[model samples]
Target: MGIDPTNPTGIKAFVFDVFGTVVDWRSGVAREAQPFLNRHAPDLDVSEFVDAWRREYSPAMEEVRSGRRPYVRLDVLHRENLVKVLAHFGIAGACEPEIDELNLAWHRLDPWPDAVDALHRLKRRFIIAPLSNGNIRLMVDIAKRGGLPWDAVLGAEVVRAYKPSPRVYSETAEILAIAPRELCLVAAHNNDLAAARRVGLSTAFVRRPTEHGPHQTSDLKADEAWDFVVDDLHELATQLGCAR
Candidate 1:
């Protein structure tokens, strides 16, 4: 029943994890940040700067997730970290708008070479949407930038809850007017799929072992038995029985 469209039993939609799954956020974010870092802190090691920014990512989100602080989107958390990181690097004279632009590095990610074509193929057979922890505006901007053909963009902004939260999964199902099992979440990160599975959504894991570049230590392979484990989105479309 959860087979997305080619199987006799129907699965109506596919919810994708945008970052690192469909788009190469690690490389994209680093590329976008380099020029800004050069202009601000020319002597600084931009790669380490990029890695440091990412290092703060989980902790910042955890603060919000743990309710030690109120809910804050990744964008906000990124900015908060950027300001501190830049100051520590002795980067000065940047205005608020510049800082904000740097923070949006996540939004301007480049899609994997196969991402666009794969989604086009899958869309013919399933309703495709983004289900991510990114805020709505950020996710929409990414869709526009990366040419992601999502039927709808769903994000933490809509649910005020992050993935791994049952409420977020249920809210996405309700918005799409489909049952939980009818929506499959395709992701590169196992934790994301694990969360989707807990809520009854079928999961697909597309391994992006080098997503973190040389910085990657985790998510090197699918640790859990996801419904499907493929190398990329195009492969996913093929497995779901989409032709071409």
Candidate 2:
């Protein structure tokens, strides 16, 4: 679909979910861990390692979501999760510096092949930024490295809360001084869009069929009546009449 030239839905901005949505975190992490895996545990499966690390993602964030842990950044959570996964694989005690370097892999993930072009077209019409769990620095780094062209960086750290929490969605709208209905949360994850919708933000579901690396069973299609559902951001732009 071509870009749309109208703003029929009244969406003033598009806030994105970065991981697995805008950027392909699963493959990116696997790619980053390949060399290290070859050197440390040559026989280990790279995808399994990445999946294990990601599997810990929600529970770690749940600690914060439930207020059991204070609002620590996602970077800290990711690093901690990485350490645990590495140790579980018997690759522990690998130099602290190297492990830390591996943790930074999240910051260097490549954008999806369509992400840059789609975002460019979408940006021409609406304000675009990452409303992600990634901390400000992480989001900023990804934007810089990937040329994502986000108008602002806002997310978990800024709100001091995680998504699926009403605060994260509501506070983002508050920060932008836009009504919840005026801002759209665009994501490849269903749970994320559902959360955003519950808090009154308009939602858009985009397809990222390979986001979880083929075995991905969820979010293959929209489960809710989202305001916009498209195959890609370019299609989203087209639907919103923001096509270029």
Candidate 3:
């Protein structure tokens, strides 16, 4: 039942986990946050500020995932978290428009250096899209700004659930009119791929050792024997038989 990395014959589409796998969210956010911080919180560390904002991401999603709150797009959750992070740092003078602009840091993420070209290569062979926790608009914005060529954006907002939610994987396959076995979930997070694997989707683990920062400890390597384990999107494209 193990997948063959070199020749994954049945996989018809490759869905990516965008945040860390395709785009460098941490660096991108920090870059966007710097000017804002310089204007407002001159004493704050840009990296710490970005990290704090991101730290709230999971819990915000968990509220919807646990059904304690109804489904809301990631944009809404991010704004709410941004307000909280600002308050946590004693930043209270930011106006709503300012907050809204800063919250869009997610939408302006820069892709990994190899991402765009590799995606173009992979797209030539298989359907390529994002199966991310980000909403459709957010995905579109990121793809547009990062120059990522996705066939479609499919994920949390589409499925009404987030990653590690079985429904996200199953429903994404349904949307593509393909069986779960014919879809491969490519991600930097081991947990995301593990969840996809549980739902019968093939998995590829792309290492993003500094996804959190230079000292990041989690997801530094694949936790399971994924169908494909590679150092970057280019490597995954190569293993998937994508042409240069």
Candidate 4:
């Protein structure tokens, strides 16, 4: 059955997929990496480096999702991946502190221009939080830096599993004390929404066409007929009857 955006009566909460949906992770990571790269591997393309780092994200989490490794926070995985990415680029000799600071780029990501205001508008009518792969601290820092008004922070650390895992979606609803059907997952990625829908949550797709960069080709349009599909958070807010 399809959801009616204008009258989503039972949805008490709106949980977001943060990285590319709410925050521009690719550009933000490249921006934060610029100074460090200039000092280290000046010749390395910042965009390429950021993409390489992002490519490591899912595989690292799969280790935990598959239960091959115990759950460790995203920060730890990012740092470990950072070391490898640095090595891959032949940019050796980065100190521990340097790598640690650079890994924090995830925390400093910028929101889409429509995000903060749309979230605030949505917040007035429903519970709003992140259902991201990022750990608590990472989510908190991103929210703080970007002025996102979340009622609570939630994700991998809280659930002990990364996204696309049924537990991540079902457990989040459990934590929020709402039925899975009463919670909605808003994301730019169809796979994330598909997982949420599989677990009985409503799903919304917000387009971030340039999330991966100008030449990006994937996830430009909704692959499935999600509960709601909008060009940006602002449109979602409007469709959901949020005040200006």
Q: Pick the candidate with the highest lDDT.
A: 4
**Global fold similarity of model 2 (TM-score):** 0.96
Judge candidate 3 at residue 189 and give its lDDT: 93
RMSD in angstroms, candidate 3? 2.4
TM for every model, in the order presented, reads: 0.92, 0.96, 0.96, 0.96
Q: Give per-residue CA lDDT, model 3, range 1-244, as digits (tens).
A: 6776655577999999999889999999999999899988999999999999999999999999899999999999999999999999999888889898999989999999989999999999899999999999999999888788999889999988888899999999999999998999999999999899998999999998989999998998889999999998889888778899
Give the clashing residue pairs of candidate 2, or none. 3-243, 4-241, 4-242, 4-243, 5-241, 6-241
Q: Which residue window of length 10 is worst by lDDT in model 1?
A: 1-10
User: Which residue runs of candidate 2 sit more than 4 Å off their true CA positions?
Assistant: 1-6
Q: For each candidate in the order shown, give its overall lDDT on alpha carbons.
A: 0.84, 0.90, 0.92, 0.93
- lDDT tens digits by residue: candidate 2, 107-226: 989998888988989888789999999999999999999999999999999989998799999999999999999899999999999889988999989999998888889899999888
Per-residue lDDT over 41-100 for candidate 1, one digit per residue giving the tens place of the 0 to 100 score: 787777788878877877787777777888877788889999888877778878898888
Query: By descending TM-score, how would the candidates be arranged?
Result: 4, 3, 2, 1
Worst 10 residues of 2 by lDDT: 1-10
Quote model 4's TM-score. 0.96
